[model samples]
Target: MKKFSFLAAPLLLISSLAGAQEGVPSPAPTPAPASQKEEAQTQLVVLETAMGNITLALETERAPVTAANFLRYADEDRFDGTVFYRAMSVDWGEQPNGLLQGGTQNDPKRILDPIAHEPTSETGLSHTKGAISMARMEPGTATGDFSIMLGDQTGLDANPDGETEDVRAGYAVFGHVVDGMDVVRAIFASPTDPYKGEGWMKGQMLADPVEIIDVRRIDSPEGDEAEPAPKETNSAEAP
Candidate 1:
């Protein structure tokens, strides 16, 4: 069993090909073609980080609850002065394979109540390259912390039949980076302090956290007006 560590606060921690039906010669029913409107059904939000901007296309239709929660934070200016403070690097798979985490970091004033977990099993989203997923301590404890994948981490996807809760109920991937992966890589490559953080997160804390200047919704769905830019503020504390 592949392990995935996407946790909140204390910690942060599938390409599965379906088997062909046996002896079934009947052709499978073709799926209906997606309309132009359906194809363009996504909410775009940009995180203007100190390093650079990272654009995200949230799967609002498929993962509504998770997407809405993130939007609420952005719309209310909760993440304005937050920083990308953790870079979990691993020497496996691709060269820059791991995750970069940032968010409210459980600031009582900035964070909202935890939302329901939306597993890949239900959302049909995978932890592919540039995928953005929530960071929770348990299956249903995710709040404002999130991570951006650096490579195709299919190992993070839910395994419905797995033996453990962590595998059966995987992390919720609500969106993906549509642009500025180079910025993501650069932040991941930034200096990390060897003596910071707790437990498994030790040595993963960024020596100098990259500030998130602003987070704004650049575009909205049909019939929705774009939200005003978030006011600048600073209230987050380093972990």
Candidate 2:
């Protein structure tokens, strides 16, 4: 048998493989799941409105108190027939921080007890586009009312360099719109009743509030074998 130069042959094979892969990029790795528990515990809630269906991914893990409060109303079907009463619209399409507000009507019978305030400082979520935050009169008065951002509003987040806690404190952002932003924008652009709101909220009230037909907690559309996902029925009813 001829001399088999094992070392030289292996070196040649390695060089050939390296040459073949010289310009090729490696495949990207898949992102790791947030957590095993988050996968099963996080929840979705679909709000059926006259315009369309708006799905929200409530961050129960981050803001337990506030998220649970919203769930209470949703689970009890109290959001049904509620209207998108206010849309703080501007003439320009660049509503970088404009707001749209609505929630269960001020019916004492349907309202639940106000929960303790969960500031954005504690939650670590910012007021970015698609963000949904609880609306309150003072610090701890948030209940049924909520607001959705049409554009980024990081200013609404807790300011780290403020003199007082109130100055740094911000609204609790428990969830965000996962789908149907077109519907949210349409509601934002709906004509306003110039004479509806009182002081600062004047002219922000929707001329015709878009009615919410149903609001219910839904399983992940990603599909969990334990439960069936609710079919998203987009409401096409004319306003």
Candidate 3:
């Protein structure tokens, strides 16, 4: 995902297509930060999908606010019917690198408010392979949408030297794929829509989106789940 540069205002509304291409706050050092994971109260979310089960460990200790935001959606059952619609393969080239994008659509009826910006510099998290992060057009636009790095992505991490007009802030990595990376691989290798999408995202949208059956918290007591809202189809409908 592209880190925004010119936009002065925080993108209050993160794009629902993928995670908002923005970043977060906290510190998740290398080697998985087991201590930080525990302190962050890192929790797991099991995603039962058409492909298979994919479990993620969120870094709540390092990125509390961002992790809580993601967990809330899972606990509320808001992700049940959503689809993993975007896959940015190495073949797609520079901008997105290797990754998969999914989450809520820009449906005003169901989307929550955008959270504050959390730069990776602030979080001390890097966009390493298997790391999960939010997406946004501008800082603070991230809502329910997110991206998972398929490979090491130092490019998506905040610039250590300095933030420039070009580098901007990077994506907030709040979790990692603890299990079911094979499932993620299978989905990534799937085809993309030839006729849909535009610009850099053109031809990057999945031809037949992988449906997210359910997202639920595995580490703590969850709240009453609401039935999933219907999936959005027109935006990606085949001609």
Best by TM-score: 1
List, residue by residue over 101-150, the lDDT tens digit for candidate 3: 88875544445678876766677677777888887656687777787777
TM-score rank order = 1, 3, 2
TM per candidate: 0.78, 0.72, 0.74
lDDT order, best first, reads 1, 3, 2
| lDDT at residue 79 of model 3 (Cα atoms) | 73
Enumerate clash totals for all models, in the order shown: 8, 0, 14
Residue pairs with clashing backbones, model 1: 5-13, 6-12, 6-13, 7-12, 7-13, 7-136, 8-136, 8-137
The ten-residue window of minimal lDDT in model 1 covers 15-24
Regions of model 2 farther than 4 Å from truth: 1-41, 90-97, 163-165, 221-239
List candidate 3 stretches off by more than 4 Å. Answer: 1-40, 91-97, 160-168, 220-239
Query: Global lDDT of each model?
Result: 0.72, 0.63, 0.66
- Residue 134 lDDT in candidate 2: 79
Residue 169, model 1, lDDT: 73
For model 2, the run of ten residues with the poorest summed lDDT: 9-18
